[model samples]
Target: MIHCMTSFAQSERSALCDTFLEVGPDAPTLSGSWRTRDLAAHLILRERRPDAAIGMFLAPLAGRTDKIQASLAQRPFEELVDTIRSGPPKWNPMALGSIDEAANLGEFFVHHEDVLRGVDPAARRQLDPAEQKALFGVLSRMGMLTLRSCRVGVVADSPGYGRRSLRSPKDEHGNVVMTGEPSEIVLYLFGRGEVADVELDGADHDVAAFRETNLGV
Candidate 1:
């Protein structure tokens, strides 16, 4: 299990690096205000500089994280991509295969799509059965937390992975079912719904409301 996860993480990292090279530095990403260079710096910081990476989720540390990421973003774009492609430094726990798999598989996958869909909204990537199952596993684990703040009930329906009830309705719009390939569902769950290839199944109002609500971690 761990070995599979590690391979997925490593492959996604490598592919994302290749994308960075292809897109250049100024390309946009689903991460708001983040260009490809900014995203690369973020990956570098997350893997190589945990101290700054915490600010990504913590309010108080956000300024510091921003400062550090901005500095890292200023490095030559190719160098940043190279550093990311090379993986974490030996001194970091992320250098360990287990930790890298646990920490980066979903993250790199999401950011990889961020760049892909950001560059072309119509773009889509087909995942193999194993990849789909792996991503669906991530969704099954994180779905509740990711959608807890949503105002309506949420059900995720990924074909071949079974369905999961992520949240209960908090409004009149009722339940909204999100249907998509696992990777697309992951992107939607991570706040990239605008570009994620997911379909919301429910009443028009319910679906609209779900989309309007900020749905992500």
Candidate 2:
């Protein structure tokens, strides 16, 4: 059961590594101005260089993080992908199976989609039921933080998984309801809304306000 729960992260990592190779280093990705090379470097550093990884979430350290990432990006693209394929080094906490599952499952899933959608704007992947459920569980646990920037209440409505109140409606104008599969919702919440296949239903102004807000961590 433990292996079953953790396997998706490993699969996603493997698939993402394959994608990095297929797309080569110059391919574009949904992440800001980063290409495949930059994204690959970011992933490697995030796992191997804990000293610099904190900058990903800490604004004050972001400059240092950027510097390290840029340096890593200079390495051969195939080499970077190979490192990612090899998984975290033993010294990293993510080398532990459970830790990798918890930290990288959604990270790799979303990033894999980022590359796919970046290459082809119309790209979409059909996730298995277990994958959907696992992603939805992450949303249920982290939705509030991911959607906190929105001024109105946000609700995620995944048909089979049921609804999660991502954020309480901040005003009486009503909630901005997002309907999609768990995987799509994950992509949307993680700053890939432009390519995510989710549908939004809400008052026009509320929707506008929600759209204007920056989302995801």
Candidate 3:
């Protein structure tokens, strides 16, 4: 089971790598101003460049990360796409099976959606049961850290699969249940709630607060 999960995770990342090529460098992304090329540079730097990767969690290093990413952006568009398609280099720790699974499974899933859903009237991508389960499992492990800012407790439920608490929020009104496919729930938790096709059930204020808050990794 462990090996299979790792294999699937790597496959998903690899598939996204291929997709980056198909989307082209100029494709817009739901993620800020990043066109596909910029997104690719960010991904590559995150995995291979330890300094930049840590910058994501360490505010002080963010500028350094941005500078490096900008330099990468100056590279030819096709070169950027091909580097992303190639995945992280063998020497990168992200190439390790367990680390790769932990880091890139959700990263790829979210960024892949970033490209696919960047447009107006975006197309929805359907996940197979196994894919849904994979994302759910990852979320259960990391939800608390992701939603630490939320003021209301969050319970994510996917019928016929599983249910888990994203976190215990401080909202006195109590928790709210977000029901949807695991993929959708994960998307919502990752701050893409506006585009995630899920139902948020709670007090009007709580639901509204959830929507208004900026939730993401």
Summed backbone clashes in each candidate are 1, 0, 1
Tell me the deviation in Å of residue 114 in model 1. 1.3
Measured by TM-score, the strongest candidate is: 2
lDDT tens digits, residues 78-108, model 2?
A: 8999999999999888888888888898899
How far is each candidate from the true structure, as Cα RMSD in Å? 2.5, 1.8, 2.2
Steric clash count of candidate 2:
0
lDDT of 1 by residue, 1-217 (tens): 3445578889999999999999999999888889999999988898888889899789999999999999999999999999999999999988898888766788899999889989998888776778777777777656765776678788889878878887788847589999988888888888888777788899888788888877666
Model 1: runs farther than 4 Å from truth?
Answer: 1-3, 170-173, 203-205
Q: Output the TM-score of candidate 3.
A: 0.91
lDDT scores of the candidates, listed in order: 0.85, 0.88, 0.80
- Give one digit per residue, the lDDT tens place, for model 3 in 1-217: 3447576566766766677777778888888898888888898788778867788889998999889998898788778766776777998877777887887888888888888788543678767678888888888666765776778888899997898887777837577899999888877878788799899899898888777766777
Q: Quote the RMSD, in angstroms, for model 2.
A: 1.8
Position 179, candidate 2: lDDT: 97
